[model samples]
Target: MANAKLNVLVAEVPEVIPLVQEAWRAHFALTFCTSLAEAETLLNKRFDVIVCGTHFAESKMFDLLRMAKSKPKSQAVPFLCIRVLDGELDGTAFQGISIATCALGAAGFVDLNRWRREYGFDQAREKLRQLVVSLAHQPT
Candidate 1:
C-alpha cells in the first residue's frame, strides 16, 4: 500500500479536464468520465478514489455519487465532489451542494474556485492533491 500508485476516477466536464490533469495526474492514475453512462461503465473497474465534477448534462453530482456508491465494485471506493464556479452555480450554491454531497457519503468536496481565491492557485492545487491522496490511503 505504501508504494502503490493511487487510481482515481475523475468524472468531470470537458472544461475541467485540464484542471484535473494539472492538480491530480502527478499524484494519481486518473480515468476521465463525462457522463453517467461513461461512469457506469467505469464503475466496474477498481478505483481507489472517485473525484466527480458538477457539470454533467443529464445527471447531477449527487446522482453520479449515488450511482458509484451503489455499485458493489465501487461501493467501498471514496467519492469526492469537485465544484468549479463556472457561472452555472455561485459560491452560496456550492456551499449547499458541498454540505449535501458530504451528507450523501462523499469522502470530501473540493471547491476549486474558493480555494484559488482564498489560497491562490498553487496552494489550492496542493490542497486538493493532499485531500485526495489522504482519502485514497484511508482504510476501507
Candidate 2:
C-alpha cells in the first residue's frame, strides 16, 4: 500500500485558514476548524497533529492544549500554538502532548502579510514536513 498522509487539524480563527492551509498543504491532510468541539471531533477521526490558535475565546490556549495532551490516543501527537506575543512556552501545554512549536505573530492575527512576503508559509511547511517524517518513522 502507499504511505498514508499525515493528518492535521488546525484550530484557529476563520481568518487564518488560508495561511494555515497553505503552510500545511504538502506535509499533511490539513483540516481547519473554528471551535474546540469541532477540533475534538476531528481528533476522534484521527490526526497526527493539532495546531491551535492562541486567541481562542472560550478557554485559554493552554486549556485546549491540556485537553489534547490528556487523551491517550493524542498524547504522542504534536500540538502547536500560534501566538501573537513572545514568552516562555508553558510546559503545561506539553504535559502529555509530544511536541509543541509556537509561531509568533505581530498582533492577534496570523500575520499573513509577513507569511507571504517572508516565505513564512514555506518555512512552516518545511517544519511540518519534518515533523510528519519523524512521526512516520517513529517506533510503534
Candidate 3:
C-alpha cells in the first residue's frame, strides 16, 4: 500500500508549512490545480480522492464539490474540503461549512487550523494519514 499510493487532486491549495505540504506528497500522489478548468482537464483520470479549498468563500466550496462530482471519471471519488479560518473566528461559520459540505455529499472536511490548534502538528498529520488510508482502499 505504501508503494501503491492513492491518486489525489487538490484544488486551490492553501498556504501551509512545508511539513504539512510534504506530508501530503509523501502520503499521496497529488495533482494540484488552481482553477476549476485546470482541474477539469485533470479529471479525465480517476482519483481516489479530491481535496479542495473553499478559497475563503463558502460558495467556492459548493462549486468545487459540484464540479468534481459532476465529472464521469471523478463522479464517485471521495471529496474532502479544507476550510479557512478567519482571524476573529467564532464557531458559527465552522458549523455552517460542515453542514453544507455534508448536505452536498462531501466525504469529509478538514480544518487544518483547528487540527493544529487542538491536536498539534504531529497528531494532525497522523489524522490526515489515517483519513487517506481509509479512502485509498475505498472501492472505486
Q: After the best TM-score superposition of candidate 2, give how far the Cα of residue 77 lies from its true spot, in angstroms.
A: 1.5
Over 1-140, each residue of candidate 2 has an lDDT whose tens digit, in order, gives 35667777777777767866766676578878877777666666677666676665443566666666667777666665554333423446433222333322111223233343456656745654565456545654
Candidate numbers sorted by TM-score from highest down: 1, 3, 2
**Residues 3-106, candidate 1, lDDT per residue (tens digit)?**
77799998888887887787667678989988888899999999989988777644478898899889999998999987774643567887788789888889
Span of 10 residues, lowest total lDDT, candidate 2: 103-112
Which run of 10 residues does model 1 get worst, by summed lDDT? 82-91
Tens-digit lDDT track of model 3 for 1-140: 55887888777644532344677777777777766667778888778888777772333667868777787888888888775444423478778778888788788777777887889878977887788678757776
Question: What TM-score does each of the candidates earn?
Answer: 0.88, 0.60, 0.83
Q: Pairing residues by index, what is the TM-score of model 3?
A: 0.83
Which pairs clash in the backbone of model 2? none
* Highest-scoring model, TM-score: 1
Model 2 deviation from the true structure expressed as Cα RMSD, one decimal place: 7.5
Each prediction's Cα RMSD? 2.1, 7.5, 2.8
